[model samples]
Target chain A: MNVVDARQAVTRAHREEWARVVAALTRRFGDLDIAEEAAAEAFATAVERWPDDGVPPNPGAWLTTTASRRAIDRIRRENRRDDKQREAQLCYDSPPEPLGAIDDERLRLIFTCCHPALAMPTRVALTLRMVGGLTVAEIARAFLVQETAMGQRITRAKAKIKAARIPYRVPSAADLPGRVSGVLAVLFLVFNEGYLTTGPDTDPVRQDLTAEAIRLTRLVRDLLPGDGEVAGLLALMLLTEARRAARVSAGGELVTLAEQDRGAWDAALIAEGHRLVRERLAAGTAPGRYQILAAINAVHTCVRDVRDTDWSQVVALYDQLVRLDPSPVVALNRAIAVAELDGPEVALAAVDRLEPDLAGYRAYHATRADLLRRLGRSQESRAAYDSAIVLAGNTAETAYLTRRRDQLG
Target chain B: MQYLISVIHDDSTLATPDEMAAIDVFNDRLQAAGHWVFAGGLAGPDSATVIDNRGAEPLFTDGPFLESKEHLIGFWIIEAPDLDVALTLAAEGSKHCNRKVEVRPFR
Candidate 1:
């Protein structure tokens, strides 16, 4: 194969086989650090050899075998410990195993990576690296952190998992609900990070990451077909993704829902999202955070024009969500909906009560700026906009806030 | 695997009679399930002393090693297969003792 073809083949192999190879090795070796490093080494080897020898017939199998050998070698070199040595000896040259329909290995890998024992940020980084097969540099770039610090974060998390003996299997039925939500939270964070990928502290819109988040969520949804929140999260991502193109202007400023061209949204994604939301509604069970949020988004996407949007239905959904989650952020979002149904005076009263809780939050300032501007309090609105612009992380958001502040005349 | 579940309290306040009864029940359950290794309620940090012998002259200090509002009031070492089991037990332990608890695995 030529160099370009070989490189393309290697990239494809890395994307497709990285998780499987890591999962299989993790099962065999029982160490995430070892499994991750070995899989990376295997891919590096593939890069070196595939160009000369051509791609293997079963690239997944080839990568798994190569990773297994490397893992055993690592065990032999660094470990004089009897237990590890025995495991290495037993795993050496083990035949490749078949994966089940949902692939228990990958599920177990994800659950372990997103284990509740780890902090949320750590869980996101670990999930991206182990489950999404993102390199440390890519992950750091996406999140806007130093590569070394990000590497240490992953390393420390792995060490903690091993040290704490965090189980490497999916949670039992009793634990599934809580554990699934934790996994979904990590996935949502990744999706949001990608969706709003640009900010002073982040990179420009990383659609690739949003796509990865959707794919992983889809995998989880398939694995737990009966889960409402899983389906809800997938639906939420799809619906939000549908408007991504119109959400940003040609000048790279954020386009508010009122200003976005409704026709520019992806109809197919919106359709699929609505279907899932409807399905959840039919499930008859009280919805959770994601489901409620999905329902809210559905209410928005259903309208061809923002003027035709159903504000009361949106407010009702937010009321349900407020009951489920009384967080300041949720309260802020509800107030935004309240502004649509009630006037700025009523929404401002509710938002002002949240000031102590949301003093440093950027969205809080932005919302206040909008509400104050609507109330004709231009000076206060300008000050609020200034706080928001200073706190805004993305360049696009900052640009949007700056324009609003400058338009006070 | 073993975990140390340390009960934390902000004062020298000991467990109430009802709490003690609940803890006794929990201990019996742990023993029945083969999860109990050892457990005890401490005498509060007021009874603790800091001892350092590595220095040429042995050093001694009054009270706990660190002065803090919250202090470890009790601890239980339980055997389990993994963190999940240990956490469940610790969570129950916290409920029985009616105080916050921290679970740390032994190396």
Candidate 2:
């Protein structure tokens, strides 16, 4: 292979195999920091050597073996402690077994990283780092945090896991529901960090983050195919991502769902997402938050025009979602649907009640502005729009809210 | 795994006779289920004292470690396989004691 082809092969291998190699090493060493470091060193070696010697036939296995050997070497050199000696022996003696088609090692790593004992932010950082194979710098950049802060957060989380003796395994069937939700929440939050960008004048779509979330979700679903909520979450993400192409106009302006061309939507993703939701619903499992949200999105996809949208069905799904997860954000979304079904006057009352909880949220102010404008309360609408404009982060949202305020004047 | 179920309550409060009876019944249930390790109730926080030894000489002080309306009134060290079991037992304990309970696993 040419130098460029070798580099491309290594990059592809890193993307596909980072988690597997790290997970295998972690399973052997029983230490996340060591495993991660070893895996990173393996990749660095690959970057330097692959261009000279070309990529291996089974790159994942090659990386796993390389990382494991490196870990053994490091363990031997670091200490003569009993535990270190035992770990080094294990790493040196164990042979690389072929992983199952489902890759349970990666699933175990996911569950461990998303353990309930860890704080939620730690869970997100760990998931992004260990499972998504994102660099600390990349994750920090994505979240708009300082690299040192992000690095310290991940280090503290790993220390907590070790100090607390959090087990490295998938939860039992009884504990699966609670534990799996933590994992799913991390994945969804990562996607949202990408999907709902608040950066000024930047590309709103974060295809990399969203794609990674979906990829990890698929891995989790394959491991737990019978899990309705998993299917529901994947379906929700896929359905939401299907509109990536149409959510923004060619001029980089925000396109409301009503104005976006349906032709720009990804039909394959929509179909797959709809099928997953339908299958999960048809299985007669009680609908969870993701299921309800996916059903709501499925309703949106059913109609060509926004006017043809089934507002009643959307409102009913939101009602169910509010029951499932009564967060302020969900309540805000439900209010929007309530406006569609009951009219802006009633929706305004609902929004007002949510003020104590959501007053600082940009979407809350934006929603209130829209409702006020619909009610023909131009003065109140302008004030609400002003608050929204001040709170808005991105140029698209600020521009849109500014236009609304100017129109009211 | 083992967990401590701390029953927190107002420092000056005391359980009624009815509440004590309910707690006894809940204790019997825990023992029967083989989840019970040990249980005890503390005197009001007024009887507590604090000791600080970071200086050259240990200094003894009279007062609870924390000045607050609430204190750890009682606690139970229970043995269970995992957090779920410990939390379920804690829920039962909370209902029986008629008090808020906090559950934490022994590290």
Candidate 3:
């Protein structure tokens, strides 16, 4: 390759290796902002020199080493007058003795980004920014928010981390279980953003988000062996992701579960998900929220076809889920499941009970409309669909409801 | 080393007696593992006493050193290999009581 091609390759490598470099540097430096700055500087230096010198055999390791050295140099220069700076310099100049054990730097970074001290929205923004390696503009666009607003959210999250003195280290064995839930929640949120795009195109934008979430969950499961919930979460994501291919139609319309093609689902992920859930269940522990949710997904994936789905078992799982986590959303899901398993009239009753709390949620109205349509209440169903259309944030979902309304007509 | 696994939280929202008994069961487990040093729930922060030794004469206070919305409800000093192990034990303590546990190294 020519010099220009080599330089382009070097630039691409730097961008690709940025996350790994940042994670390793953060582990060494124990400061997210400094690690980020040093890693960026290392990448800039690599861009200027790597093309001329040729790419290193191990680019990521080289970037990590260079970033650590850069961080040490910057700290020494800035803290020349402070005594603690001398100690920090000595500590950095001689790196810790390399232990050949597998370090969970990326998982630690994820936990730090999803620290409970930060607000949930801020946590999502920071996780995407630091761990997912998405830019402010990308995240802002994905969430349909302003770039400045998203940028400020990340800045405030980082500031909170510093002020709270949130440890950069991974949680202890006992704390790991609780902490895992928060990390999973952040990853799931990221995946949902991409899996259900609210944009005008009416199609999912970044399937990579769902893939990344599964990857991160797998990392967590590996780091904490015998963590059933972690395994369950990974299984849950896999089972849900397995259906992604059939979630929308050729015309980019949302397809309900009963309408999706089971043949198009990723069988490998479904098999792996079922295996994990079975293993966890056999361990003789009471199921947590993740485990229960995974079990529900497992049931959904087990059917020969959507019509073969055991709606009764699904309703039972939703019952367990509501008992475990009494969220409005859970109740909403249970109502739909109940409608499928029992009668539309019973489901309509459950929907009526939920209306006081779920008046603002678009899905509640859409679900009510579906149940009403099934019960042959055409006028009520149309009114409910109209209400859902007004509250619907995503264009595709609104279109799906509109189609359902037309079908009722 | 005997480490203090301080269970800090608001006293007003303290666990019930049955919950406290459950915490004792956890403490028993820690004892069986030979890590439990001592554990007890404290009264409200208003019952605390603080001594200030900065001046010529040491000043004494009737209540806690700092006034805050969330006060240290209780503490446990346990023996463990390191901070990591101590933190794990502290986390169990927090889980049993459904509150936060701050594992501070005793000087």
Candidate 4:
């Protein structure tokens, strides 16, 4: 290939191996900002030099080694003029080895980014930017927030880490359980954003976001075995994600669970989720929220059709979940299950309790409208639909609500 | 070893009656397991009176410790073998309460 073509190939290769390379480099260089800078510099250096010297046999390893050297060089250069740079210089000079040698380092990075010390929004932004490799603008776009706002969030998070002197090292074995759960919560939120996209232009089914969440969860599970919650979360996400294809119609209208085609669900993910849920249950420990949610999803996935779903069992699980993690969101979900098991009127009352907390949440209003419509309260249903339409983020959901309102009219 | 698992969050965010009853069910499980020592959901932080009796006349203050977004929501004293077991129970409390739970050994 020509020089231009070779450079293009190198860039592609770098993008493909970006996570592994950056992760290994981050272990060597403790600072995320410095590690990222070094990794970029290494990739750029390769694009310029690889055309003449020929591509390395193991490009990821070469990039990692090169990034470590570049980090050391930068530190040394800074140290020449400043005494304070000496500590950083020492850290870079004897950087940690690659993945096999530093099993816990990447997990530490994940935990640090998702640290409970930081706010929820900060945790999500930091995780996506640092681990998911999403650009600031992309993350801003994903959340429907201004780019400047997202940038400030990330900057503030980094500052907090530095100011608090939060070490980049992995947590001790004693602290691992708590820290790991925090990391999983971050990833799960990221996936939820994709799975339930409320953006005006984009489809509600965010396949890319869902896929990334699944991949990260799998990576964490592999690194830490016998982590029931990790497996539970992965299973939960997969089971939910399996229904993506049938979540909405080709016309971009929302399809309720009962109407969706069972065949369209991803059977592979379903099988994997089932296996994990079973394994976690067999561990003989109390089920966490993730495990409970996974079990709930498994119940849904295992049913032959939506009508066949064990609504009573689902209601029981929701009862347990509401007890386990009593969020307004969980209450709204439980209300839906109650609607199926009991009647729309009972569910409507249950949903009413959530109105104070979920006033701004579109799904809450949308579900309320459905329950009202089922009870033949046409005017009330239309009003509820109107609220949902106003709060709805995505075009698909807005359109779906609009149709429901029209039907009521 | 008994450790105290203290629920700490904004006083305004206290769980409602239904939610509190759910927590009662969780404590029931713990009690059945023989890990529960004593647990109670506290009233608002302002209801707490801090007394400093070092002076001739006792000085009194209206609220709980720490002036911040967080407050002492509630707590449970449970017996566990070590920090690991204590933390596991703390995690359970945090999850069940849907809030932060600080696990500290009883002095």
Candidate 3 C-alpha lDDT tens digits along B1-107:
56677777865866889888889899889989999778788888888889989999999889888899888787888876544466567778888988887765554
Q: Model 1, range A115-145, lDDT digits (tens) per residue?
A: 9889999999999999889999989888878
Off by over 4 Å in 3: A1-20, A44-52, A80-103, A199-205, B1-107
Question: Candidate 2 lDDT, tens digit per residue, A1-409?
Answer: 6889988988898788998988888888878999999999999998888888889888898889889889988887776656765564354332232333344889989988998777888898899899889999988888778999999999998876654456667666666788888899999998887787777755577888899999999989988898888999999999999998898767666777878899889999999999998898789979888888889999998777889999999998888888878898998899899898889998989889999998888999999999999989999999999998888576666777787799995
Better of 2 and 4 by DockQ: 2
| C-alpha lDDT of candidate 1 relative to the true structure | 0.89
Clashes of each: 4, 0, 0, 0
Each model's TM-score, in the order given? 0.92, 0.85, 0.73, 0.73
Model 1 chain A, poorest ten-residue lDDT window? A92-101
Q: Which of the two candidates, 2 or 4, achieves a greater lDDT against the reference?
A: 2
Summarize candidate 2's per-residue lDDT along B8-51 as a digit string, tens digits: 99646599999999999999999999999999999988888899
The positional error of residue A275 in candidate 3, measured at the CA in angstroms, is: 2.6
Cα lDDT of model 3 by residue, A1-409, tens digit: 3678767766676556666777887776656787878987887787777767887888888888888999988777777767684464235321232332436677668878887767888888887777666678978877779999999888877765554445566675556668878888887787777677666653454676677677667766877767778888888888999998888788767888888888999999999999999999899898888889999999988987877889989999998889989988898889888887888898889889987899998889999899888888999999999999987466667778888898886
lDDT of 1 at A83: 70
Q: Ignoring the other chain, what TM-score does chain B have in each prediction?
A: 0.95, 0.94, 0.82, 0.87
lDDT of 2 at A96: 35
TM-score of chain A of each: 0.91, 0.92, 0.87, 0.88
